[model samples]
Target chain A: MATFIDGFLWYFALAVFVIGVSGNLVTIILASRKVDLSVPRDSAFSGALRTLFSRFLPDQHMLSRIGIQVVAGYMFHLGLFILLFFAAPHVAFLEENILGFGWTAAPHWLFIVASQFAFLGIIMLWLYRMTNSVSRLISKLDDHVATILTFLVMLSGCLALLESFETLRLLHRFLVELLLIYFPFSRLMHAFTFVPSRLFTGAWFGRRGVDS
Target chain B: MSERLERGLSKLRSQIDPKVKSFFSSCVHCGICAESCLFFTETRDPRYTPIYKTEPLRKVWQQEYTFWGKLASKLGIAAPIAEQDLADWEELVYDGCSMCGRCSMVCPMGIDIAQIIFKVKTGLSAAGFSPPDLAETTQRAVDIGSPMGVKLPALQAQIGHIEEEINLKIPVDVEGSEYMALLSSMEIMYFPEYISALAKIFHQAGVSWTLCSDAFEATNSGLQIGNTEVAGVLVERIVAGAEKLKVKNVISPECGHAYTAIRWEGPNFIGRPYSFKVVHILELLDELLQSGRLKTTGKESSRLTFHDPCSIVRRGGVETQPRHILNAIAENAVEMTEHGAMNWCCGGGGGVSGNERAEPLKLKVFNRKKSQLEELDVETIVTSCSNCRLVIEDGLEANDMEINIVGLTEMLADHLVVDNSQ
Candidate 1:
């Protein structure tokens, strides 16, 4: 039964990842091609390196506590990135099928840390959506839906990771599979949307004689 | 001191049409808006951020209109949308925002924050929050047919006056002209050189154009009064005048917002399709340059820099043509750090320059642009917006700085070497 559950979650996750990754990659590639770099490239190697490093640092400028929602945003993102790269099943799949360069999977203790951070982030965000007038103003039906899905996924991931109970693990794997199928259609696709969108923005702002 | 504060609000709430109220119902506060605001950037005040500035209306929307707001309303938990609420937040809604779509550029949800603010202003105007000058202008536009209150014969006299000054046949209702020349209140009342330039260019290019004396003013109060009805009426007179003459295209002078009002908003407001194409005078000049119909002597001695007016550049999308013209006409056209679409606003936009309550606010805002000018160290600044020209002129005077503010036509007119030898 345990083996069957793992098989189901992995297959669904793989299918969704493949479609989401391809769709977003095509969008990014098309957008990049359409963007004109003909404006004399003022780009420096130093700026590229700094941009790469800055992603790791906190985006402190827009980070005033006013983005009380944004802090939750950062948390969900950070946790999702960690879990995507370092989860044991994901690592094994990446090594065998995709990268052919596998590393040791995160241990139970590490999943515990990731779960706490991801859950706390999701909760803070949920609280914000409920409390803040501004957040309430801008939020759509999908935002709350995404939050509920994330909460379920994080809650289930922890239960499954702890090997807490057989029934609980099945429940977690079932919900996780459901989300993998849903990810492509939802705002969860911001993961894919933001890449070329940022590049498109950078190119346009540069052309308009603006500082991005 | 006696308690003389009116403390009471106006009766505009019941007057607002409900379609606009639906617009106020739509803003969600993701606040991708903060970085897009000039006021937020300048003052560094969180309250000035477009999202924050729009809170009062957003609260009313959330409380009265939305699903959750309905729930809050039923429970008596949410505050009612009150007179004092609209009255208290008037400045925050109108004066705080310049209605620039910079915030809309960054909006992930594609919400037009500026449009929402304008709609809120409309609601406030219905709620009796309009400034006296705006009300006066609307009344003047309705009665005298111009925001500037120029009587029609008086306008024709001004036209005759400019024709004499320029030594050209300035035609009024000249039969079957190629273009219908529209004069903004800025040019008709104050800057005659621009009107003269129009005459000189039309004569030189050999393009037939005539101004209408019937409804001479181009300052549409719709943009100022937060109502499109007056704008519609003003636009109809102009559009009808164009149709009456049977012209090919309409040409707007160097007023930036007025250009947008005529070129873009005119078509949108008037509903029926226009037979004549609407155009900015800069684009007309660019067409003249492209066709080799008009050429500048390329003779200006002052080292110049171009400031892209938000009206012409961002709103009108005529940024390139003006800069192209400026570079062609000037010997040394150096760029200020922020030029083109991202250029800092001259702080005179959104009818704020003419608003008496916002006059002090305009100076504070113009300081940002003034400082940018100081940094560039250019002697002459050429811009395309008329209101920008007025505000920047007021700003320079207030700050005791000496910088020449030349309109595109004024600069173009100066470069014209009329053939006296012929």
Candidate 2:
């Protein structure tokens, strides 16, 4: 039964990750592709590549703007990664199905603490969105929806971690599955879209001679 | 109002207005974007805050939208839209603001205040709340074919005078020219020297280039005016000019908003991209330098810093090439800390250039740049855009700082190996 459960989770994770990541990436690619074909000869492809990375990837110029948000964003993401992948359940799947690399997992106390920190970070982000007019204006329905869903998934996951009940774990698993399924369709796809959007906006402007 | 504006006004209401319902409904006086504004930072006034700047249209939505608001406003239980409101907020939206997307950039929630501001600006333009400068400038553009109202005949006369002085036909639309060189309106008006410099450069490089008499003004006032109809019509003229000449390559002058309008926004606005390639003067010079077709002999002054135009840096992501172009021409090119996409505005961007009323407010907001100049410890500030030069110069004069606000080509053209073979 353990093997079956592990197999199911691994397959589920792979399928959803592939779909969600790729779908968002494709949208990003399409948004950038919607440029005039005639604009490229003025610039070098390499210039576009440099611009793409500098605009999106951590640059000194962007540091001041992204400041606290960047720290909070990274903190929550790191915590989620530890909890999601290094959890015993995820490790069982990883060992049995894919990586086959066994590593010491976080202790229960650490897991609980990390989860709480991630939750707090997410709340901070939510509060930020609610307060900032720019964020409020620009946010789409899907963005808010994704945020709530992700928070619920994290919240449920934390609750399940606190309990020793199998049913509670199953509830957490269901919420995670729903979130994973909704990820591609929702603004949670920022992980995929952000990079390409950066590339496209940069490349388009760079080609057009706005590079002063 | 002209017949043109009458038409523009009626059609503006039909545009998307996507979230009019929720946008007005969901605000709770949270001032997270106070520091996000270059204007607010300069003014330190609560009224000029980013969210407050957006209140005009927000109130419009409220009065036209909610039951309480509609009832109150209709019954005169609340204040109605007034001329003072529009006058006070014009700077908050246009002159005092750069719409740099910095606030959007810094927002932890990624709300995109800049987008809403643009939308409100668009709406405001329809209501004829556009500043006099932009309105007048557009009139001058359409009537005289350039914003400063330099008519074609007078421009031709000016070019002829320069031709007499320099003794070059200046190739005003030679039939077999390979490139149609576009000039921003500013270069054509106050700084005809840059136009001649371009001619000298082209002649030196042995490239066939021509200036179109009909489509002479490359500066699209529509972008500044927040009037898309005027922008669309102006773009139509540019496309028509390009097609008429059938040039393989079009050289865009080193104007920030002009490049954005013609090259980036042009393709998007014109609905389909052009058949010919558009190149900025920097891109063209970079090509010329790479090809060894042209060379610069002299060095620009030391301790020179670049001023990033809001249109060029923030909106266009044109932060590096100007520096590269400057570095090539100058002995020492120092970058301001807020250089490139993060750089502050020159206070003359968007539609603020032509406005007389916004001038004082413009200088007040531009004091930030004055501080940056003092910090950089630079004598000359070389910028890529014409309006940037104009505004930066104005700011310098206002603050009692002595600085020459020079354009990219005006400097590059100075080093031109003038092809005297004409």
TM-score of chain A of 2: 0.70
- Candidate 2: tens digits of C-alpha lDDT, residues B219-296: 887777677667877887887887888788777777878877886678766678787777777777767767878787
lDDT per residue for candidate 1 within A146-189, as digits (tens), equals 67887887777666666658788678777777777766555565
Best by the TM-score measure: 1
lDDT of every model, 2 decimals = 0.67, 0.67
In model 2, the number of clashes is: 8
Q: Candidate 2: which pairs clash?
A: A134-B111, A134-B112, A134-B113, A135-B111, A211-B318, A212-B322, B133-B354, B133-B355
Instruction: List candidate 2 stretches off by more than 4 Å.
Output: A1-38, A41-66, A84-86, A89-106, A123-160, A163-212, B1-37, B40-93, B99-129, B310-325, B416-422
Model 1 agreement with the true structure over B1-422: per-residue lDDT tens digits:
11211211122332222322322322334454665566766676656667665555566545544445677689998666666666676776666666655664444433345655665666666656767787788888888887787776776787788877776777888658898888777777788778888888878888888887774577777776677666777888888898888888888767776775776667656666578887778888988988989867856778778888876776456777987787777888888775665577777677777678887777887778888889878789888767778888999999988989888788887787677753
Model 1 residue B392 distance off true place after TM-score fit, in angstroms? 0.5
Clashes of each: 6, 8
For model 1 the local lDDT of residue B359 reads: 77
